[model samples]
Target: MRTSYFICGIYVLMDLASSDERSFRIYFDEFSIKYKVPDIFEKMDSTLVQLNNRSYINAEMILKRDVADLNVRAIMEFWKPKAQTNMKLYDVRVDGCNLLQSINKNKLFNFYVKSFKKHANVILKCPLKANFSYKMVDWFLDENDLPLFVPLGTFRTITEYFTQKRLAIRVLVHGKVLPKS
Candidate 1:
């Protein structure tokens, strides 16, 4: 028997070794890819930006870093009294290391925003590919949460991260299993 699995917006292929010879099997929930965005982007002026949607990330080296232990800094942009902008910097330790899984699902969004607010004053650099500029700052949890900051009216560039699609999975058994030694 052979089985394939997909979880959390990632395509995962799982093959069962026949040596076990266990007839029974088990499966988990339907996996998905979901995350939070900073409240700043909610503003009308902070239009949706696409990061690496059309083009691929081309780089010689991809570095990894931890977000919890980074020195961060943010610059405040004052335009309108009602609508202000803040550009904070964060240093991600590891890139492409399943950031979504790092945070506990119940408090995932809250944890990220809190991290931004706490570390809003340090020059943070990207841990992954440098050319791939589009990155996530914070995830908003409640309606009361407002924009911490916004960027200038004209953004130099924008990147759209895409949602991973769920692929069809089918499992079948070729033959029955016999007792093991």
Candidate 2:
């Protein structure tokens, strides 16, 4: 079996692990934030950092007031050269409080948490305290723990957070999965 495949002349994707393409990796290409209630943000930033000879995203978000009654909706889309448009891969909306307490109900969400758990000090529960900093230090996708088969491509996630049904913040993350070579 082929170890990897070239698709649409756009990217090379590794075959399943049963093959010899075990060096496929995931990396963040960009991180961005949009504040709906700009005044509510005390500080928010995301940047790339090198640690242990690998790259990671260091992100932090701090609010000016205690945040509660939060809801979250996230959509993940993929861009394939052949499609010429984004294709929705997954979409989920959850009550922030419930999600923190019962992430196991959503395998995708649980997987996300696991990927960042090692390097993040972000609170897992709701009602984020005012002036308290939430952080992800030297956080990168844990390829070894991926729960789904991610094809090689440019992927984007739009994450929106709401308080009392009103949009408070938004996060846009771009990432890519490719052959390590």
Candidate 3:
């Protein structure tokens, strides 16, 4: 299992080795391909823009997955608010394979978030002690004590050899605010 984090996104790669069955590989990659920001101050600018009247901005994210050298197993678009807490997971997959269906009916994918005065922490709790956690971007607040822009964060989980072990790949992202006209 391998984990990588970048200013724009995160990527996780894993290789499953098996003695009887053929080897399987899985990957999870996500990045912010588009955004509008003028400069550093723009990220801190809490004012509502014409594109949206909300204090938070929407970033277009690219989610890609591959399994057993099969490209384009899944591609999706996900949007996240600048500020969030205690997100939930409704699905679990391994190399494009669904694991939630085989797991215990009572088990669930849990995600936790805690904010501090300076920075925030995101935690992904998986079954069988396969957990991932990371300290994310520092929160910027306005004079009114409201968030300006919470940085983007993402994580992925992959299971190797059926049940031999599980790997969790986590990433914390901070992107450059594009210049505004």
Candidate 4:
């Protein structure tokens, strides 16, 4: 069938693949996060990390946004890295608990320092908590220094590239939600 698509102008594209099992790809697109779930509808094979021989998956990723007061709660994803190629995401929750919890700013600062010490090559910035709320953690980073989030295409696209994996990170900055205009 022909599907209407628009990038700059309207165009028609052929749509194949049966409607049974499908996959959803999530990628960070500049300001907001974008998710694409193929039209194929049956059941989705939710695999967090599809690696080679080793496979490990996280249950879920929760993101709480408080736009009114520049604050956001990011509940980290929980995953157990198995052998080397077998990875799967068991649970997927966006708002759960803060895994990396530091008692106070001093502790958080120390934790950040230690993390950088371990991952020397990586550029990880110090995390800052929003003045309004503690749950909302924001990273202080300049525009030039930011990490790029790329999502691998679909099964067809996967073959073109390699397995979907987060490329090298440029810099780690805590993100803060700003009041909507």
Number of the predicted model whose TM-score against the real structure is largest: 2
TM-score between candidate 3 and the true structure: 0.15
- C-alpha lDDT of all candidate models, in order: 0.25, 0.77, 0.25, 0.23
| Poorly placed runs, candidate 4 (over 4 Å) | 1-68, 83-181
Clash count (model 4, backbone only): 18
TM-scores of the candidates are 0.18, 0.78, 0.15, 0.16
From the highest TM-score down, the ranking of the candidates is 2, 1, 4, 3
- Considering summed lDDT, which 10 consecutive residues are worst modelled in model 4? 154-163
Residues 33-120, candidate 1: write the lDDT tens digits. Answer: 2222322122111112223221111112112222222221212122322345623232122221244334344242445445444433
Once fitted onto the true fold, the runs of candidate 3 whose alpha carbons sit more than 4 angstroms away are 1-79, 93-163, 166-181
lDDT (Cα, tens digit) per residue for candidate 3, span 100-137: 22333323321111222234342212231212222334
| TM-score for candidate 1, residues paired by index | 0.18
What would you estimate as the lDDT of candidate 4?
0.23
Best by lDDT: 2
> Clash number for every model?
15, 0, 3, 18
| RMSD values, in order shown | 22.6, 9.0, 21.4, 21.6
- Model 1 scores a C-alpha lDDT of 0.25
Which candidate do you rate higher for lDDT, 2 or 4? 2
Q: Model 4: how far is 76 from its true place, Å? A: 1.0
